[model samples]
Target: MSRLKNLKKLLTVLRVALSLVAACTFSTVSSAALEESISQPPDDYVLVRRVIDARYFTPESVVSRPDAAGTQGSEETWPDIKLRPSLNLKEALQSNIAREITISEQDALSKVVLREYGFGQKNSLQAYAAIEEKIVELNDLGAPENLKAGAVIKIPALPRMALSEPNLLNKYNKIPKGSMYPSLSKVTSFDAFNPVTQAFTEKPVVSGDGRDGSPLVIEHLWLPKDYKDHLGGIELDQSYEEVQAQVISVNMESESLAEDYQSIPFLSAEERMIIKSKLSGQPKLKPVLIVLDDGWPNDEAFYDSRKFVSEALEMIKKRFNYPVALQHPSSQSRVFTDYPKEAFHARSIHKSLATLVELEPSRVWDDQRVRVVYIPLSTAQVYSKAMLEELVVLRLIDDFMLGARGDPVPDKEVKAKRKIARDIVKRLKQDIGVKDLSTDKAIIESALVFADLYAVASGNPYVVNFSWTTRKREHKFTHFDFNQGILVSAAGNSSLNNCKSCRPNLAYSKECECADNAAAEERWFAVRSVSNQDVVAVMNTARDGSLQCRSSIVGSRSVDPLAISFNGYVSDSICGTSFAAPRVAWLFAAKLAYIPPQEFSIYDAPDKGHKLREIVKKSRQGGASGDQYGLDIKKLFEN
Candidate 1:
């Protein structure tokens, strides 16, 4: 009986031991399956389940793991893997972590997974395949077709080796070669005398005459019909009839009158005295009209237009004693016209000149005190699309260098920096020899051209009208003496689309809208921010006192008085803020004509906007509200 009991006990102990062994075997198999479920990282990289707090993951931080026997040990006995002194530990750890991104319409699967986050174009196909597979496994995408638009997915961390590999596609990574600007075959120098002549020095690619190697003719003298006839054979390339018709078209004569009555004869001495008496007390110095735009008409067409404009102004001076004779300093009326497409539009120049001379129907003249100077500095034909993009890239590099320094650099160093900037531009052009239309070249070139022209327009007490606007407004236009006079710029025609949130309002206003789909509000803010005492920005309004849908708004927050004018034609079909700006310029010129030279110096001082706002307020008409002021040519002549 004792032997049987002992056997039972022995059997029970053996069964218990067998149960423990079976449990251990099941646990081992389960651990293997769990390990296989989680994707393994590529060699030389560790899988980071979660990023440790950066404060605790310092260079002094140590990583600990179990011993090779897979058994936990005392803290001191566990291996401590110290980070290398040369390693950027934070960056290294961050690179190994997965990143989440939502696909954009512009994003391609290959670009996102391979070129953007994984190895670049220089990597092998096997490397790309590995990355794609890792991405699919990590996101459970199953297949490439499953990666649809707006889908969120995880990008697998890149291998450790990728950090050491240079990315050639990054423009910042490429070291610019020695003397980039000076060594280029086309670009010569960025000296103040002639900064960017790369596009101008070479013959224009477009087919046209009078673009290059043509003598520039400027018509400064406005001769009376009597003087023209006496000087006989003065070679008016345009017929007398044509000149008469142009004069009528510009509102120099009543269009309702007979053709025989259209001719403007010489004024009698009595008529001159009567006009002179009416202009008493105004400044003797003539106000300057600086037209900074694409080049004016070329050769004969240019001369004829100038002759007609001058003669028409002379007629006003003789008949009404208005200040018609424009001040000619050095006998040069047209300053810069070096581009190929200078003669593209004669009507634009004609309309601008006519607007400066007089406002139609109301017949309000610029008091005959306006002088004209043309600068052809706003044409996009000078550069290929590819060249323009290269220029922008160069500008970005320059901005980065300057921003990194964060200190005021000396003049000598500034020149050196400019040279480096030019060099980069030249090198980029060489790399991208292909010609294509640039996405943002027009805006970039507008700023560059204005900068160059600003230097040329300096030194004279002038009212400069820029019928253009650009997104780039931070350019340091050297040698531009803003003290000379004020700049009247058009508040761009970029407000066509209304902000959906601010419906029924033709344009976006800061008070009612935040942003638009086209980001036009941001652009409008940029345009308004550039305005001050020295720069007067004008917007367009319709005859009904409503803002033109296509006219950019000067936000209510602006301290500068908003100058709004009729954007539609009073005489011809021409319209836009382009026409509105010159009308404001003309009005400002009239105001400046009464201000003494000593008082005119105030424009150079800060807070000059106070005085400018006052001027705009005093001359403003009935079609304005709040901070806005509409232009009235008649109010300009008021005391």
Candidate 2:
């Protein structure tokens, strides 16, 4: 009885307390709240829960704050500066020119010309006026046109480019992991094809490889004056109407184009007159060069340059080994080069490399940095025999030889050829082991880019370049690759490519055609190859991502690239998939200690590769192609 009474009393008291609590809750919900008040608040108030307080981020060592009233102050430093056109003061000074010069709206062109030519005060004003009148009469005879806006304003510099290219030939900055191109430059004559002639004779000599090229000939051909006589004089196994033999020639000296515009355009007679009055000045300023030409050349017993620059850098670090580099997939490049140079410019390749370093590229627009453009649709030939047989072999096996007939390459038929490429890239790079390389460094790099030019242009500390230029695309070639990552490249050799295709049998080339099959092959010896950014080595970075190796260069279609021309030897070397940009980036790492920042400026290191990749990531242009990996040579040493 006592226990029941105690329980009833306790229940009554509990019920009374619950009623009071409910009344307070309802009142609080209906009333305005305060800092200490626990009731419904205004829209501005966001809920804050603190299970574990944090003042800093661990591992990364970044200072952080808890999500509370006091933590809203942290923000990106100077958000406005991220844009390209916004122009931070110093960046503005780096611009080509400040302004444009213009004449009045009602300016009369001939009247001004007459006045400038001393018409009125020339002792014979009537005669000068008569001359002007006669000139006007001639113009009237030609055609009756609007004479109100008569002044033919002379624009000294073209608006097509950003005025003069003397300073910033800012390339398409496509931030590594960011966006696509957003820059320009000067003194860059790197046009890829001749817009006017479109002939092989105008192309530049390639940087790396044997005189003619690899054993497998591509699309070009070389003919000698004695071809008819030589074949006629001898009894050959195979005969043709013209030259019948393919010979390998070697002559090393001279080569390629400048990406930025280095030439000065004529604004008026003033420029010409000034040159005649002044004495010869200093040396000419060159462009920032990059390249990569691959293959088996340094090993050949017969012909080799005075210095095999490709392997020259290895001498500096004989003990340390480096990472093995490989090609990424083409279908996945972020910045589509349509040419081939797009491959190595993989967003991750640069970003990851930049991450290793620590700095990043400045852009025109800060908000939306880069664009990643992924291309997953597979078509025809993507990989070169060298890349597929070499670095990718470990990734793939004999079961993946996909051609017109999807089957593996027969081991017995092409074992030797396959071994050459695989042997070169797959070895554990503990030290410089390759024979063709001149130096002792173990981390040898290769690419579609011309590393020799990069070394020469950027001034690598421990690098000797092996590259050259040429007049005809079908002539002998020169090339090299090396440890300390000296990259190289071969030009796309061909004739006037007037936008056409080959004959019925696919015997005649797009540029050069012949009546007979044998004649066409002989005529187009160093056959012109097609490229689109870094297609040279569209490596399968991870998930089938890629970058380009082929690019258009600085040269315009009206003129062939002034840079070195190159091509594969036989009909087999069809695509100009030179392992370019990556090779230049590789040399950047291998020769870190010896040289200063050359290709791109070296700033404070901040995950060098990451920054490079960030440039693309921020742009988000390459999309799927951004997945490929590459070295960030720009951040070798944090400036």
Best by lDDT: 1
TM-score of each: 0.38, 0.17
TM-score: model 2 vs. ground truth: 0.17
Error of 1 at 65 (Å): 47
Per-model tally of clashing residue pairs = 7, 212
Candidate lDDT (C-alpha), each? 0.37, 0.23
Candidate 1 lDDT by residue in tens digits, 1-639: 999999999999999999989999999999977653442211111101111111111222223222311222111210122211111222222221244567787666677755443343354444455456656765688876567778666663322222233343443222111111121222222121112211111111111121111111111111122322322221212111001100000001101212232222222355334333434555645566666454444443334323433443344334333222332212255432223532232235345445335422223233355555443332233222222333333233333222122222223323433433233232222111111211122223333433222222332245667665544322112212243455676765554444223311323355335322112333322243333334566666654445443555555343443445444333333445665677677657656666655554545433443554456557666432532356654555554
Q: What does the lDDT read for residue 559 in candidate 1? A: 47
* CA lDDT for candidate 1: 0.37
